[model samples]
Target: MKFDVLRAHQGDKWYGVGDTRDAREVEVQHLVDRGVLRKAAPDVLNKAAPPVQNKAVSAPKNKASK
Candidate 1:
C-alpha cells in the first residue's frame, strides 16, 4: 500500500516528512497504526483520463429551390 509520511520515521526503511512511498501492508502496519503514515492521495498524473470529443456534430444544411 502507498502511504504519506506524516513524520520522519525509520524502520527497515527510512521515511521523511511529506514523502510518498509504497510498502507492503504487513511491513508498515505498525507505523500506520501509530499515525506515522496515512494513505496517500491518488496521483493524477498516473491516472488515465478518457478521451473527450469537443466538437459538436451538426446536420447538413439544405438550400431551398426556387
Candidate 2:
C-alpha cells in the first residue's frame, strides 16, 4: 500500500514526495498508528483523471417515435 507522510520520519529511508515509499499495509498502518504517516487522499488512478468513457447507455432519444 501507499501512504503520505504526515510528519517527517525515517525507517530504512526517509519518506516523502519525489521519493515515495511502497510498503506493506501493516507497515503503513504502523506509522499511521504512531502519527508518522497518513492515508493518501483519493486522486487519479488511471492514465488521466477520468470519467472513463461514459459507458452508461442512455435510452434511445427517439423512443416515443418508434
Candidate 3:
C-alpha cells in the first residue's frame, strides 16, 4: 500500500483510499491514520493552468461539394 501511494505520488496522481490495491475503506483509513498517505491539496491536484493550444498545421479543406 505504501508502495502504491508512492507510485501514485511519483506519477503526479491522487491516491484515494477507494482506489488502492486492497480497495477497503479501512485500509485506506489506516494509511491516513498512520501518516503514510495524506490528503493532497486541491490546488496541487486541480490548479488553474493555461490550456495547451495546438500550433500544428491544419488540414486542407475539401473544394468539392458533397
Candidate 4:
C-alpha cells in the first residue's frame, strides 16, 4: 500500500513527515493505527515533476582573435 507519513518514523528505513512510501498492507495499517502514516491519495502519488527548460548557448570566441 502507498502511504503518506504524518510523523517521523524508522523501520527498515527512515520515513519523515510528508514523505511518501510503499509498504506492506499490514505494516501500513500498523503505522496508520499509530497515527504516523495514512493512506495516500491517488493524485498525490501521481503528481508529475515540473518540466526542465533548455537554454540556448552561444559558441565562445577564440581569445587569439582579439
Candidate 5:
C-alpha cells in the first residue's frame, strides 16, 4: 500500500498521504531505497513560496483602457 502511494506520486514534491510525518518519511526512504522515487530538491518543496505578487493597479493603464 505504501509502495503504491509512492508509485502514484513518483516525482511529486509530497505524496498526498495522511500518514504521520515519521511514517511518510520512512515510506519515502523505502521508495528511494527501492529505486522507485527520487527526493525532490529543496526549492521544489518550498511550501511557503510567496503568493503571486503582481503590482496592484488602480485602473487600466494600457492603450485599450476605456
Candidate 6:
C-alpha cells in the first residue's frame, strides 16, 4: 500500500494524508478529526516517489560437499 508522505513531525514517524492502506488512512483521518494533526495536501507526495517492490534473493552455493 502506498502511504504517500505528506507531512512529517520531528523528522520521523511521519503522518500524512491520502494513504492506500485504509487502516492507516482512517488512523490519520482520526487524528485530523480529533484536531491532533492537520490535513496535509498531496503536493509533497507528487514530488516524492513510491516504495520499491520486493525481489527474490538466491541462496549462496556451498562447495564443501563436493
Best by lDDT: 4
Candidate 5: worst-modelled 10 consecutive residues by lDDT:
1-10
Model 5 residue 22 CA deviation in Å: 2.0
| Tens digit per residue, CA lDDT, model 1, 1-66 | 788999998866787898886989888888889999988777875468889977996655755532
Error of 3 at 4 (Å): 13
Tens-digit lDDT string for candidate 3 (1-66): 222342343223565443433335554666567655555444465467889999997766765632
Winner by lDDT between candidate 6 and candidate 4:
4
Which of the predicted structures, 1 or 2, would earn the higher lDDT when compared with the native? 1
Per-residue lDDT of candidate 6, residues 10-66 (tens digit): 223445444322235555665456544554446575566777877877565867644
Listed per model in order, the count of residue pairs whose N, CA or C atoms clash below 3 Å is 0, 0, 0, 0, 0, 0
Off by over 4 Å in 2: 16-19, 45-66
Task: Report model 5's TM-score to 2 decimal places.
Answer: 0.29
How much does candidate 6 score in TM-score? 0.26
The regions of model 6 sitting more than 4 angstroms off are 1-23, 44-66
**How far out, in Å, is residue 37 in model 2?**
0.6
User: Model 6: which residue pairs collide?
Assistant: none
Q: Please, what are the lDDT tens digits per residue for candidate 5 over residues 1-66?
A: 133333444244555433212236564676668755544445456468688977886776786975
The residue pairs found clashing in candidate 1 are none
lDDT value, candidate 4, whole model: 0.84
Q: Higher TM-score: candidate 4 or 5?
A: 4
Model 1 local distance difference test score: 0.82
Against the true structure, what is every candidate's RMSD?
7.4, 8.2, 9.2, 5.1, 8.5, 11.2
